[model samples]
Target: MCVVHLLDNPDSWAPASLQGLNLCGECNDQMIADLRLVAARWDDAQEALHAGAGGGGSERHAQRIEAPVPINVSVSDALLVARDNIWSVVLRLVDDHAVQLPVYQDTGSLAEWLSRSQAVKIAGSADKTFTKNAYWWIRDAAGWTVTATHGAETKVDLPDQFCKRPGCNAQLVVVENRAGAHIVQCSADAGHTVQWDTWTNMLKSLGAQKRRGPRLSKKRA
Candidate 1:
């Protein structure tokens, strides 16, 4: 029943778990788990989309910034799309697989329905690409949830770069501001910073200069 290449162990696909289904045992379980978690996080994502990390209250660990907080409408819109897509998946399960809908249709009920009902019967919805489909769906939801819950930007250190400002020895870190725009700044001083796009251009210019080497003056003679 295998047609596509799988990267995980047992590289080759095995016989379907049930008739007309394409998921292997491990993948089948994973898909159900993903669906269940995605359902559980549905409302949290909605809150994150509208609540805005900068809002008062717990602020959900919102980062304290000196500058006007970046407005990341792109990221917010993406969260909305993720939620809608998740709902679409839930609808498909209902229509195509006869999965029962919860009476309330809220996140809590959706999670409960999946845990109690569909978790056991998702095998009926498996298709050749079911595992991949489930994985792709979970990624966006998980990222948005984590961002909303933590109000933190993922930090990546630049191995080759370090702060040269006096009294500062910290390395450079790259992070996306709330605006969904990338920034490269010193871990210790936000003042020693550059926009990601500007940094990239600077790198390119430096490389060109290095390739051209030092300029030589005409021979004195």
Candidate 2:
């Protein structure tokens, strides 16, 4: 992870979040890339600081500073949050930390927000899809079976080595199906069931995929 010195005052910051935008039709890959570049630069700066430097001047002192994580500031807090129907990012500058700012971008439509939220949820599901909490089903010679769900579910079959959850461990097998939903029996019993939000989020994500796959939106202004 990159590191940077945080200014003592939280008020100082550049535009950190995207702002003044409607439902974006696509994603902003360039924006993402730019963010990554910025992160890399910060990482370089931190590395340079870690390497002992001869006593320079105020600039060196400033470079030596490190920023605290989960930084609280009025600067815009950029995010890649998904709403569902429309995907967008924001660069809004927070005026005050006390004010409860909107976590997601304001698209001026609740329906739009709901859709975007659903899409975002689904996108998140696609990340660790093999995990038990994710919506994972298998349709072999038997029939359509759910491998994992909210409660204790099981799968039946011996595929030697297969993923129990849709996207958790890649090395697991369907032990047995107690009910309609298939149960996931993994070699690594990582104590942690699929989170409720993750399950529902997967549904929303799948729904979004049915509509639009990955997209990109850029700042024209």
Candidate 3:
């Protein structure tokens, strides 16, 4: 479920405790850890919010400075949305999935609790969507936190890949989150996104097919 993870990588290929939760063990652990990090960075994001430097010498000349203006607003908004979604998912995990954990009042507390407890029940939840969505929620939060705290990371454009969305041929970009997770997404606002492993595996499969050559049809009687 993690963006940095390779679908074919055997290192993360452990079976889930429940068949309903399709995520592997590494992804489960990583998801919880990422959630904790999202909470941890909230303060950092707040500190950097609208703290972008303007034309001034007091800017403490650094190699990279926080992004200014619209970028700040966008990152902040994204982080807020991600946080809300994550909390909602956690609540469902506790109430619906029968997790016996106490929901803390503060974001940091609840996040830390999840990190410590590892919320195995979440990984074993009968709700198949929770695992996948929880990971994405934290993933988006982590990326925004990194952007708000530090300037936006360098987004490498995928030259060969273009957005599959019709009328939107924007090049795809590979975004790396604070937790080392990555996603291949459309550079434009089409919201056409693909997981890294999914894209890589597709390329690999196509390459193998090309290498094998096209199958010939047998002569009919």
Among these predictions, the greatest lDDT belongs to: 3
Best by TM-score: 3
What's each prediction's clash count? 0, 43, 0
Tens-digit lDDT track for model 1 on 1-221? 42112423243344545454554666556555655665565555445544444332222113333434443443343344345445655676777677667667654345456656764444444554543444344434444444443444666887757776888889887766453655566887544555464456445444545544542221111
How well does candidate 3 match the true structure in TM-score terms? Answer: 0.56
By TM-score, the better pick of 2 and 3 is 3
Model 3 scores a C-alpha lDDT of 0.55
Error of 2 at 3 (Å): 35
Pitting candidate 1 against candidate 3, the one with the higher lDDT is: 3
Per-residue lDDT over 110-192 for candidate 3, one digit per residue giving the tens place of the 0 to 100 score: 56666777456566655546655566655555555555456454457776666868789887887665555555667785135
Q: Write the per-residue lDDT of candidate 2 for residues 125-213, one digit (tens) a residue.
A: 22222211111110110111121111133433334433335555554434332344332334454221232222334334444454444
Instruction: Give each model a TM-score.
Output: 0.44, 0.19, 0.56
**Which stretch of 10 consecutive residues in model 3 shows the poorest summed lDDT?**
55-64
| Clash count (model 2, backbone only) | 43
Residue runs of model 1 more than 4 Å from their true location after superposition: 1-21, 39-46, 50-75, 130-132, 154-221
Candidate 1 has a TM-score of 0.44
User: On a 0 to 100 scale, what is the lDDT of residue 193 in model 2?
Assistant: 26
